[model samples]
Target: MLPKSYFDIFLVILLVPILNLFVYLHNSFSTSLSYLGLPYFIEPDITVDADHVSSSSSPATRRCNIPLSALLLRELLPVVKFSNLVDPPNSCSVCFKDFETEDEIWRLTNCRHIFHRSCLNCWMGYDQKTCPLCRLSLVPHDKEEMYNERLWRLCNNCQL
Candidate 1:
């Protein structure tokens, strides 16, 4: 019969590598699962009808001019600043007038979105709430109404 001490040594030697292998596999599986769990936004290879395109496509593809309320919100959010606005050689979205150094403008903090101050002001005339590019909603001082407004905008934008 094998001595008890020899049996114990053999068991330890055999189990140690197996335990290490199990631990290694567990760590590898956890890393792979984490990667798999991440949200991956990928554009589908198939094309859809033009009508659906506006609703389904990303904000970068949206045809409707940026809303005004979104532009005005810049004054309130620390994310946006007045100095961030720049003079552009491009055309003004509101007047369809070309940009001149004299013309006022603002850039979106998240995406560096540039727009003529007038264009954004005209948009604000209606609602005046979020950033046009990133679409980050601003908190309105009047609680209930602003919250509802923010929720609606988020739903609409997120669906697209």
Candidate 2:
């Protein structure tokens, strides 16, 4: 049988290439991994708790009523007069319309202002509650229609 010293040397020899290969692979992978935007060496799937129900997952029957209050000032009042001349016929402020087409008439929600839905959605996503044009306050005061008029008053105050 081989001596203990020989076995020790044999083990060291066997491990050296494996250890070197591991170091090389680690270095190679680490450099590539840095290019990807990640905080750590590993990431796990995000999980939500059972107590929290997703808004999208909420059952239609369980929620019987619409959040009427969530409607913006524009939806609350349809009779209010709005001006398309503030920006331009095709030039919408929401998307910064370049007046490209006649069909591109921007609809101002009941808020007496105008914007492309794309731009407005982007703006609203940031939680702005006023019309971009008339500056009407869009928050719901109650279930009544006064919310639109109240917003208009707020807009008037803002203009002054």
Candidate 3:
């Protein structure tokens, strides 16, 4: 019943907002999904940005090539019984949960900082290898050599 121009105007008014809303929602969902993945990484020790970032802007540091074998790292972090702790914290730093006698904890050798085993393993699952409290290397300085040697020998990984 409406004139063609009226119909055209009505469709333009309706469809433009719908299209914009669709795009906005799609981007929002994509952003939210991307946001969900960000929390897993506490902080990576190293990052490489190529093509866009020029060498002049950033200092080039030699790669550490640190071995991060989960099995070997676990051996370095000895599990401690809560009741046996010489001076245990009341709660875990990562989860902020109270420690119980039954709860097992892992000690970071370098810093002597302790965390709930589950919390520490979850942190390690994110490829973190630092004491959560002290920000010190989880791998002891002396043991780093042995760790690298064992990893390379066992895994036969090439540096290049």
RMSD of each: 14.0, 14.9, 11.9
Q: Of 2 and 3, which scores higher on TM-score?
A: 3
Return the TM-score for each candidate structure: 0.31, 0.32, 0.53
Instruction: Give lDDT for model 2.
Output: 0.47
Q: Give per-residue lDDT, candidate 3, residue 23.
A: 89
> Which ranges in model 2 have alpha carbons more than 4 Å from their true place?
1-88, 99-106, 138-160
Predicted candidate 3 versus true structure: per-residue lDDT over 34-136, tens digit per residue = 6986421432333322222222333123222333455457666688899998877899999999999988898777777778988987777677777878889
Cα lDDT of all candidates, in order?
A: 0.51, 0.47, 0.67
TM-score of model 1 (CA atoms): 0.31
- The best candidate in terms of TM-score: 3
For every model shown, the clashing-pair count is 5, 3, 0
